[model samples]
Target: MSAIRPAAVVVLAAGEGTRMKSATPKVLHEICGRSLVGHVLAAAGELEPENLVVVVGHAREQVTAHLAEAAPGVRTAVQAEQNGTGHAVRMALEELGGVVEGTVVVVCGDTPLLTGETLARLAAAHGGDGNAVTVLTAEVPDATGYGRIVRDDATGAVTGIVEHKDATDAQRAIREINSGVFAFDGRLLADALGKVRTDNSQGEEYLTDVLGILREAGHRVGACVAADHREIAGINNRVQLAEARRILNDRLLTAAMLAGVTVVDPATTFVDVTVSFEQDAVVHPGTQLLGDTHLAEGAEVGPNSRLKDTRVGAGARVDNTVADGADIGPRASVGPYAYLRPGARLGVKSKVGTFVEIKNTSVGEGTKVPHLSYVGDATIGEYTNIGAASVFVNYDGEHKHHTTVGSHCKTGADNMFVAPVTVGDGAYTAAGSVITRDVPSGSLAVARGQQRNIEGWVARKRPGSAAAKAAEAASRESDGEG
Candidate 1:
């Protein structure tokens, strides 16, 4: 297959997005586990641009660091002050240090919903029509915040883009608005940008003015109206951020559902692009699968569970749990309120019952920690039974120690293993025991005090107690009967 020819891409990420009311750079805000600029970068990368330059200003350091990590090898240009889109584009052209040849695509950083397919279409339309500039446009019910597209009524040629504040009544009523995305003939972008002026009402160099310059220079200006208006939506505040999140999530979930994964409630299930579900896997409502989580076939998670960087093998079931950096083997059962921390590993058919918390531990196949247990820094052999309310005392203020239980062992309720300790195969520990020493194979360990009988102890403790009153009443009744 032939490689796609590279085009120049200039992304404007220099605005502070002041209305977003955040300390962080607006383009750094995230939705669907990806920052807004990250989404734009992903789209731009699809084009295989020859020269990729991101214009950075407000919180430039943060944005630069993020770009270094998320999208490496892409160059950055500094827009020293908050001017306007035209000025930002001019900075990008200067950073090229040479001519921007074939084509140039200009995009806003805060449009996370923009897809590579739409960008490809825009570029194709511009190059095909031999247009000097192609303005990506959208038709919406309300065009209040967008620039109005002014067209020559009879010839149907794009005359100019009038900002809302500068538009007259007739122009303001135009439903078709400029989406702030544009494709320009590379040779014309630099010349047209230079001719753009800041004489408008806002006294800012509007890139919209570039379209007028190209038109007056006897160049053909075109428009590519996007099919989905939301594709060109720009987020300026939290409300718009939330709307974009909903749209992006719906798209992700729809794709997952079509791929044979079963989602019980699409509305409440939040899955990152990094999450994968094999066929027959079920994800219930209120589940968040984040940070590279994977569920094998037939694995079920949810009813309010949250997992990050965890793996659930086939046929495993996790309910109402919170797990991070853990692994559950096939057919294993976890939760109803369990918490599994980093390094927790459960073998096949094993059970981590209700109200249990485990960390840095491995429970062998067929083992069961029934309920109300805290196990950390431990290892258990197969077929072991850990009774309810049992604990592995792994910490002694300064450092943590290990506990090991061998195969076929039965640990009684309310037992505490004071580490570092070991229990051999087939060993049994009595209820309410606290074991500090190791138990040999096939042995029984009892470490609690024995019970004692003390008759009349309650009578001695309380002279006028209920027993004394009952005894006197019974004697009086017997005498009366006699």
Candidate 2:
């Protein structure tokens, strides 16, 4: 038998996903912070395809945009209309232009959990057996909605694929179902795809029809049964999307736990596919780590926190916070209710308190922002203390400015530093102050309204009227008593 030729991957992603009920493109809907197509593309990359072609429709622009951002160098073809799987592949073939000879693996974009190993195994079986077509099959208990694979009892070769809608009672009883993934001789696939017709009940060109054509043409069509049926599941609705998410999460969490990461409650802790954690990194329940997040050894993550595209250094602790595009250094402590926006960085041993928000700012080592503060577009030196209710008023409606606080500085509660101000090292701001200018090193700045007393002012305003009214009331009461 000839060796398996290098294969090109064609991912079908043209389904409208009407059941999903959202404006977002179906393939672009995320599973663990990654688009469904993104996951499939990563798996296909493992096979080292000579070329990768993704058939996009529905929201073509949105799907292409996401693919461009998530996986560069991937080629795309537009399926202008919602069509059957066979038609989708034919649309993608236009991008290949002339005829080429190799294996062509066609897979569904929504089956994100299809692993690289399974594809490799399928390709090997196809080439080793010299089959003209190889179909990946799984024996699912509930195959009600899937296409049942009809095999010849003697040869165990796939004779046909009967769609559930058209299958008889006995055919529906068969447990083996077609996964819609196929590895075919490139030339054979190109030839067979042209022969497919849209005479089915749905009035769409069916890919399964190609199996019968291959069979009648004296070509050997083979089927490889997958060990796990879940590998073949596809996402078309929100319920299935959630199921895929749970499965993916379980796979990642299991791998991490085996690698020495501590996941306290895997059920409630959601980790993305690209997230990594070192040994002894403990993740608490209700924590969601997404989008290339990393936690170093000894780091601890929350009982209710969400982190994305961020890094947490060793020994850092994050709890009940929402952080994105931020870095927490070693030994730093952040939030039971803090918000760390993009570009926020906390140095080693730094502390961010409850209700504090940090945006586009950096806090030096040991610096503290303790409760009820907004530190945006600012830089704080080491060991500085930002008191409760202190704010770096960074915006003036039209523009944003920066505030600088030097080392060892302290700001009292309710202090407001209007932007374009600086507090030198060791400076102090009194409580209830609104600082508008720079304060030199070691100086104290107190800006507030002066206090005044008005004790007897109320008594003088109602002076003689009080005694006259009292005597008049006494005389009236005496006359009434007589």
Candidate 3:
């Protein structure tokens, strides 16, 4: 195969998205766990554009920040005002410096369903026909709110793109609509953009105007209709966002199930763009896996759990837990109500009981952390037992510290360890102990306030004592004289 031409991609994301009624940038709004711009950029990345320029305006900083983190090395151009599409392209052109040659693909950032294959096909058609402009078109039942493509009857070439507001009655009936995506010869696009005028009904320069300019200049302008119209749907509000998300989620979910992953309820289980599951991995209803989470073979997740940036090894079971950036080894079981924060790792066959919170800790194989405990910044060795309400008190007012409990160690209920402390191998901590110092290997540590009892204390403290009796007698004598 010949080398793919070095094409430049310009993503138009300058709209204020006023209809979305959100302070966040429109393109930054997430669909299926990724921002809309992210999906668009990923599609563009597949084509390996020589230079990717994203045009930003409203909430430019937010858009730039998100793209920078998600897609490093993507170039950005700013449109300072709410100008029309043609003006947005002009802003990006200024950032291009020298004249651009070869094919250039322009896509809307909000069309998350447009696949890389569709873009590649558009480019291939544009190059194959030697056309100056190839407009990506789609035929929809209702073309309202879209530009209609007008073609010459004899040559079957694109004559012009007429906006809905400016189209005549006959033109408005055209089934073929402009997809707002295009592949253009770079030099011709730059020259034609200058010739477009703001004399249309909207009093704004429409990028569609360039089709007329190119045709009038005696250049071949063509149109390639997309096989699927839904791919070009643009999101302008929350309802549309939902529609786009549904489309994206359906595609991802179908692919996962076909790959042998078991989704008990695909409708209720939400998976992000980067989540993957191996064969025989079961995801129950109400499970949400977000941000690069992976489940190995034979792992069972949820009956209503949320996992983020975590990994589950083979045969692991995680139920009703909220886990973030944690690792669970094979055969380990976690939660009906547990939280595993960043850096928490459960070893093979270990169990994290209900209502427990573990953060920045590592539990060794066969270790069991029973109900109602908080384990933070600690290390527990193999076969250890941590009783109910046992807390590794890792924080002092000024600083945080670590606690280490060695292999075969047993901790009783309601025990507190003030770190930096160590309970050595085979050691034991008695119930109700407040440990502040290290305990040597094979030793038992029990620190608690001594219990004391006082008998007959209530009787001795009664008010009817000698002093009270005298006062009562004086009062009786005074009342009798009165």
The candidate maximizing lDDT is 1
User: What would the per-residue lDDT of candidate 1 be over residues 1-482, giving only the tens digit for each residue?
Assistant: 11334468899999999999999899999998899999998887888888889999999999999999998898999999978999999999889964588889999999999998888888888888989999999999899979999989999889999999999999999999999999898878888888888888878889999999999889999999999999999999999999999899889888888988899999998877678788889999999988879999999999999999999999999999999999999999999999999999999999999999999999999999989999999999999999899999999999999999998999999999999999999999999999899999999999999899887566577779898777667767989953
lDDT tens per residue, model 3, 1-482: 11355468899999989899998888989998889989999988888988899999998988888888989999999999866998888887778874587888899999999998888888888899889989999999999888999988998889999999998999999989999999888898899888888988768878888888988889999888898999999999999999888888888888889999999998888888899889999999999999889999999999999999999999999999999999999999999999999999999999998999999999999999979999999999999999899889999888999999999999899999899999999999999999899999999998988889875454457667776666567667989943
Model 3 score (lDDT): 0.90
lDDT of 2 by residue, 70-132 (tens): 888999988898778888888877788735488888899989899888888888898888888
lDDT of 2: 0.90
> What stretches of model 2 exceed 4 Å from their correct place?
1-5, 453-482
RMSD of each: 3.3, 6.1, 7.2
Candidate numbers sorted by lDDT from highest down: 1, 3, 2
What are the Cα lDDT values of the candidates? 0.91, 0.90, 0.90
- Residue 20 local lDDT, model 1: 95
Provide the TM-score for each candidate, comma-separated: 0.91, 0.91, 0.91
Candidate 1 colliding pairs, count:
0
Model 1 ranges off by over 4 Å? 1-4, 462-482
- Model 3 bad stretches (over 4 Å): 1-3, 153-155, 449-482
Most TM-score-accurate candidate: 1
**Model 2: worst 10 consecutive residues (lDDT sum):** 1-10
TM-score of candidate 2 to 2 decimals: 0.91
